[model samples]
Target: MMSSIKRLLIGRPLQSAELGEQKLNKTKALAILSSDALSSVAYGPEQILLVLITVGAAAFWYSIPIAAGVLILLTALILSYRQIIFAYPHGGGAYVVSKENLGVNSGLIAGGSLLVDYILTVAVSVSAGTDAITSAFPALHPYNVFIAIIFVVFLTILNLRGVTESASVLAYPVYLFVAALFLLIAVGLYKIATGQVPPVLHSPVGTPVAGISLFILLRAFASGSSALTGVEAISNAIPNFKHPAPNNAAKTLIAMGSLLAVLFSGIVYLAYYYSIIPNAEVTVVSQIAESVFGRNFMYFFIQGTTALILILAANTGYSAFPLLAVNLAKDKFIPRMFTIRGDRLGYSNGIIILGIASILLIIAFEGQTEHLIPLYAVGVFIPFTLSQTGMIVKWVREKPAGWIPKLMINATGAIISFIVTIMFFLTKFPQIWPVLIFLPIIIYMFHTIRKHYDAVGEQLRLTTCEPSFQIEGNVIIVPVAGMTHVVENSLKYAKSLSPNQILAVYVAFDREEEKRFKEKWKQWQPDVRLVTLHSHYRSIIQPLTKFVDTVEHKAREANYQVTVVIPQFIPKKGWHNILHNQSSLLIKTFLLYKRNVVITTVPYHLKK
Candidate 1:
């Protein structure tokens, strides 16, 4: 019943042969891959003003120049990652680039940063989308946290259906958002051109206190760097694209980067021209829409589309995290479970994990985009710097045809990124200190897991020992609760093993019940020996394990293998499974790690 519900919701399991069909075209790929960075126009500019607002209303003018600086860095990263796509077509982005060019430790730093950033991308994007909804309908503000979590769950289910299917569903909302913003920008620019400026929320610019300074400028730039957060996602998931993934991805990168620059610049300029104030209750984009469209259908349309696109932006993270995890797992740095794909060919483990982590962040931060904004870009910068540096190393070592120009571009990005990373840590230290502290710890964990996997491989390698050909007879043990068909089935399965000896053991809690069982066994006894174990503590598995240990100790002396056969009862109804004690399950669970004991089960299905 549960599986039926799952199949209904997420669709049927997809075949491996259909994976080629799952590959995305450039249009669908742009929607799913670039949504996070594109949607940053919703809040990126406001993050700049959020820092500048404390000074005074007059200080908002600095936002334009600071935004331009962010764009410069964004341009460098775009060009750097275009090269990254062609260089590492297999994906892994910064992690693979740094590991091969720099060192494994540097690769861990890049991978760890990317991992944390993907999780934060989901949290920050969903929370901002919730803020958009609350701005449109003020009454929903109280439930924004809950709504954000539901958004994460919805995206998880959508992605779990398969990548191609989700891209088709999500592509429209992204185009809608871009269209809304383009309309907003065109209208606002026309209004300004005709000398019909929009009204302000408050009149008369206030006095400047603690006015423009280098510190505030740097802080605002760091905060607004959220605009560049998900640009690396496309490079990280190159395989999601069609054949010639690198060329296709690089083109998509240019398209996404161009849209981001125009939308971000136009929105920030309009926000400044209209004197929109940054606030938690209402977003900058919402305010811009209200001022430009007079709170009409177009205004609500903008808000609705903004919310939808922002929520869908998390698709970038869903696309990248599993691919990154697969890279780490193959290198033996993380758990192998992350390497496993779901029924739909999506990385189910990574998707589920990213969902849960995003939900926790929403709850912890109370779904406020402002608080999550500080922790957002702090993660991505490390990867950005390392990826560029790795690219520089690649160019220096390989010296391709146009190596000098490529090296200069990556060098510029690496230098800019390294400085901004330091600034982010310093400017947002109070809010982001926890994340900075946890990074080294995550890197340490990566090293430890890699070492453990290496140790296991070394110990398990067959090259250390010579080949042995030996055959021996088997001794089988069957534990019976009574003289029922279940016991008969268990014994029948045990005898099929063709054992040297068979022992049917029973753990009795009551003397009277034991006598009756023994009498029945004796009457029906036509083949094997029956032994009884008395349990004074009334424990079934404990007394049974003791008897098996003694039998195993003697069996090894005779060069015989011991096999334990147990019987399980399966009910017709799913809920009826809880009605039995499940003794066979308990025995198997306890004896699972024993090197000398082999355990097997014979299950009998009950009609009622």
Candidate 2:
């Protein structure tokens, strides 16, 4: 019944052969992969203005220059990643490039940073989307965290269906957001040209307690760089694209970068021209929309689309995080379970994990974009620096076609990214410090995982050794509760394993039950010898475990193997399990670590 429900909700399980059908074409891929970059326009400029507002209204003018800097960085990053697409077509993005070129430690750092960045992507995107909702309908403000978590869960279900499925579900909303923003830009520009612009209002401000400085502008730039967080996602998930994956991904990157630049620059320009100030009750974009559309239908349309796109942007992390985890698992840097694909061929483990992490962040920060905004860009720029620096090293070593120019571009990107990372960390210390502290710990975990895998491989490696078996045959022990069909089946199976050395042992806690069981056994004339032992303390596991230990010790002394076959009853209904004592579980747990003792459970399924 549960499987039917899951199949109904997520669709029927697809075979691996259908993976090709699941590959995304360009349009849908852009919608799913680029939503993060595109949706940042909803909050990126607002973040810049938020930092600028600290000094006074005069500092607001600095936003334009800061935005231009971000655009420049965005363009450089796009170009660098375009080269990365052609270079690492297999897709590990920075981690792959850094590991091959820079070193293992460099690769681990990039992987750790990207992992944290993906989690923060879901958190920040969902929080910002929730803020968009609350801005439109203030009465729902208190439930924003809950709303954000619901969105995460919804996206997880969509993604678990398959990448193409999620992309198709998300395409219309992303396109609507694009059209809404462009319409706002076009209409706002028309109003500005026709001298129909709404009157600019300056909310009363507090006296400047701290003067604005160069450090303030740098911090604002760092804050605005949130726009670039998901740009590398395309490079990381190139395999998800249709045939000519590299070319398609490159085209999508250029398209996404172009859209982001236009939308972000236009929004920043409109915000500055309209003298929009950051208000706690409403968003900068919402304020700009109201000034242009005067709280009409178009205003609400823009708000609705903003929220939809922002919520859907979490899909970018859903698409990329699992792919990243697959790569890590392939390298033995993490658990192998992450490498297993779901019924729909999606990385189910990674998707569920990303959802849980985002849910925690939303709850912890109460779904406030302002708080999550500060923690956003730090994880992003670390990988930016490492990946670009690794690319520079690649160029220096391989010196492929046009390596010099590529080398120069990546070097510049590396330098700029390194500075931005430092600034980002300093601007949001302690809160952002969790990621920094956990990075080294994650790297150590990777090493430990590798070490353990190595140790296991060494232990399991086979070497030729002469076999010694003075006591030629194996001993099979069947532990029975009574003369029931479960025991009969187990005894028959044990006889098949070793007909000459089979023993059925019963530990008796009640004398009357034992006498009745013996009487029935004698009447039935079972083919095997039955050993009955009385336990005065009434401990089933202790007596059974000690008996098995004694048998195994004798078998080992004679250089022979011992097998313990146990029968277990499986209830037809799950709830019926509680009515039984679970003696089989207790006995199995006790014998799990015993040497040379092979334990197997033969289940007797009960019919309702």
Candidate 3:
């Protein structure tokens, strides 16, 4: 029964050969890395408009400038992270950067921030896709969470199968999205030039009037920066790329950055040019598509493209989150299980955890991208700020051959990222501070676990010390399994201890075996005492436990300390616990409660 459950959760173990080659080629690596950044074009404009809707239709035009600023920031961030990939080609990413320059605590902050951002990336992208589908069909709106969860489960399975397999599946959709977006932009611009464009969208919400505060404008730009969330995903995924890790990673980043810039710029321009305003009354993307291609199949095509892109964006998070987590686990920041690779050599535990967490967020936020937008950029910018700062420190400490040039770049990137991070905090503080509050609590919990692990490790470190103890009237009890290596080892250990008396114990459920063992004991050791306890019931723990109690009671009456030597066989495989539960553990735990008793384990290692 337990085997069935194990098979259901983790499936079969994968051999090393099944994992294929360690290196991923440039093309495949680019596909895997660019997925998140490219998918950003699908909903990036929509998120900006969702924020501007509070002010009104006229303010929606500002999305263009906002997107442009985000593009600049993203480009700078990509270049800064590119240096990171080259410097630490082993794929430490932000965590590595901060650790090497800033300190371990700084690295942890970057790690925690990235972890939260990846989780939110999955949630926001999947929920946004659900919204797009609901807009296309209108019927799925009520069950968005359920639909999103189903999608996450499907993607999780794909990820568990293999990274290359999942990447191949997503590559086409991402390419199609890039093509369709450019086509829409070109076609929409032609219509505007020909004076065939329709009237601008009218909204009851206020317009972008003169004298709007600088605070409001900064807020708008900060909200627009959600498009930049997935830019660093490539850096986190560098290790998964094929041979010449740095070169492939750098190329992938360039492709991702260039593609993201074109797609994001086009989407923002098209949305603004078409006057796509936030409508709580209607789905914004569909409404915008309808305006772009009136009464034609192009509308359905654009809508379909958008939905596919958003779903694929969620898939990007599915790949990245696990790899980042695996890196964290290797650094001892998270549980070791997360570091265990799946049958396909991917971080299966991390992927499943990410999928489940995303599903919960979808449910909690009710699959509304607008509702989650406040919590979104906070995590993204936290890592951005830390990573850029770390890079600046790196520039200072290591004065390379091109030190002046790199320092200038790092300084510029740091200033830009730092300002954006500040803007995000200022704009998102009221509605988003709760998320910030919760993150530190999680970091603290992880820190506590790390501290505990460190303490236990310190305690377990072996030192040169003799196994000597003052014997206080000892009567040693050795448990024998009739004849086994473990029994022989137990007798040897028992004889080493300074005991005035010694007795060999054998408990048997069958009388014939008990009688045979008693007769054999006399032949084996003529002088050594042997005793057998019998029970009609075939229960190993209960019979042995009762016998130990009887012997302890007699030893207490005789005012002698009892030293029990138990022979334990250690399995070679880690999964051997599935074959045998904690029977020996239970007996040892029960015996530890007794006063004036010492329980020693004589372990026999099984050969692999």
Candidate 4:
């Protein structure tokens, strides 16, 4: 039933040979990878105003300049990542570049930050999209968290379906959203140019710098910096693109960046001219749409599409996080499980982990976009600075042709990104202190995971030395709960192994039950010897494992190996298996690490 449900949700399992066919073209790649970045235009401008509005009315105008600063930073990142794509086409993005140039520790830091950034992107983007929905309908205000989580689950399942399938499913909506915004931009710009729109004043007694300080402006910029968060995704997931993967990824990055710049600038510019204030009740994009198109179909259209694109923006995280995780896993920084793809050739573990983490974050922050924004900025900029710096290091170390020009671009990006990050920390220090602690914890976890993998590799390393131990015939132990056909079949299977001896052991809590089992065994004239152990506390696993240890030690005294053969009832209905104790599973799990022990199962099929 579970497999049926999984099949229903994600479709049939894809063959491994179909992996190449699953790669997306540049157009679909843009929609998938740029969704997060493109979607940010919906809230990036609004986040800035939310911060600046705290200062005063006129400080709202400061948003224009701050947004321009964000745009400049955006341009730097696009160029820097293009360089990264050019260098590492196979794609590891920040982690690969940082690791190769700045060393393993820096690489781990970059990987950790990107992982955190992707999680926050999904949380923040979905919440912001939910805000758009609530703003338009006003009926969904109470269930925003639930709605956001549902979106995450939906996206996760789509990704698990396959990369190409998700792109095909989500691409149209993303393109529609982009076109809708471009229409909004065109109309809003015309209205402003024709003097039809006037600046809506938030305060009548507004004065510049009256209640605002430099810190306030910087804080606003930090909030808006989320606009640049998803830009690195393309480079990270270059392998997801079609033929000429790096070149295709670079083109998609360009396309996404262009859309982001135009939409973000236009929204901020419109908001500045119209004096849009971001409120819990209404998003800034909703405000702009109402101001430009009023409560007409166009307004609803913009709001609906904005909400959708924002939610879909999380696809960016869904796209790259798994790919980035594969890179970290390859280096043993994360679990090897992440390195394995699903039946659909997607990194199922990483995708599922991202979804679960994003959902938790949504619940933790109560689906408030503003609450997650301050935290989002930190993760976004850390990787930005590191990746750019990594590129600079690459230029200086390699000295490729035209390296100086490339170095200058990366250096400027590194400086800009670093300054913005530091400013974010200083301005939002009170709110983002938790992130400072969280980041180091992630990095430490990375190191701990790497050390464990390293240790496992060390243990598994082959040596030229002789074998450590000798093995002879098996000492088979058959565990029985009662005299059933299943136990008899298991005993026979054990006898067929040509073992030196076979012992059928039973742990009895009641004396009457033990006597009945022994009588039954004597009547049957079973070939195997019977051993009964009384457990006063009625503990099964502990006593059973202890007995197995004793038997194995005694067997080791001679040149013998221990084998435990257990009978399993195969229920017709899959869910019926859960009704039983499933002691065989626990037994196998416990005895798996024993060096000289072999465990096997004999199945007894149920008719019903």
TM-score, candidate number 3: 0.78
User: lDDT winner among the candidates?
Assistant: 1
Put down candidate 3 lDDT per residue, 198-271, tens digits, no spaces: 54443223444655566776777777777777778778887788767788889888888888888788778767
Model 4 alpha-carbon miss at residue 555, Å: 1.5
TM-score of each: 0.95, 0.94, 0.78, 0.95
- lDDT score, candidate 4, position 573: 86
lDDT against the true structure, each candidate: 0.89, 0.88, 0.75, 0.86
Off by over 4 Å in 4: 199-208, 464-467, 593-595
Q: What is the model-wide C-alpha lDDT for candidate 2?
A: 0.88
| Model 3 alpha-carbon miss at residue 14, Å | 4.1
lDDT score of model 1?
A: 0.89
Give a tens-digit lDDT track for model 4, residues 1-608. Answer: 78899999989988888999998998899888999888888878887988887776577778778988999888888988998998999898998999999988888888888898899989988999998899988887999999999999999999999998999988998999999988998998898788787544433223446778877777778788878888989989988988889888888888889989998999888888888877779888888889889899999988888888889989999999999999998988888999998988899999999999999999999998877887887887887888889888888888999999889889989998898899888877786788779878988999999899887777777864446778767899988888789988898888888644998889999999889989988778466688988899997777788899999999999988889998888888888988998988887888888767889999999999
Please list the residue runs of candidate 1 whose C-alpha ends up more than 4 Å from where it truly belongs after superposition: 198-210, 466-471
User: What residue pairs clash in candidate 4, if any at all?
Assistant: 35-313
* Candidate 1: tens digits of C-alpha lDDT, residues 1-608: 89999999799998889889888889999999999999998988998888888887778878878888989999999999999998889999999999999999899999998998899999999999988998889999999999999999999999989999999999999999999999999999999888788445333334344667888888888888888899999999999899988889999999999999999999988888888988778899998889888989999999999999999999999999999999999999999999998989888999999999999989999998877777788789888999999999999999989899999999999998888888888887888897868889999999899999998888789885745533377889899888788888888888788634889999999899888878888889657789899999999989999888998888788877888988887889989878888888999999888768989889988987
Backbone collision tally, model 1: 0
* Best-to-worst lDDT order: 1, 2, 4, 3
TM-score of 2: 0.94
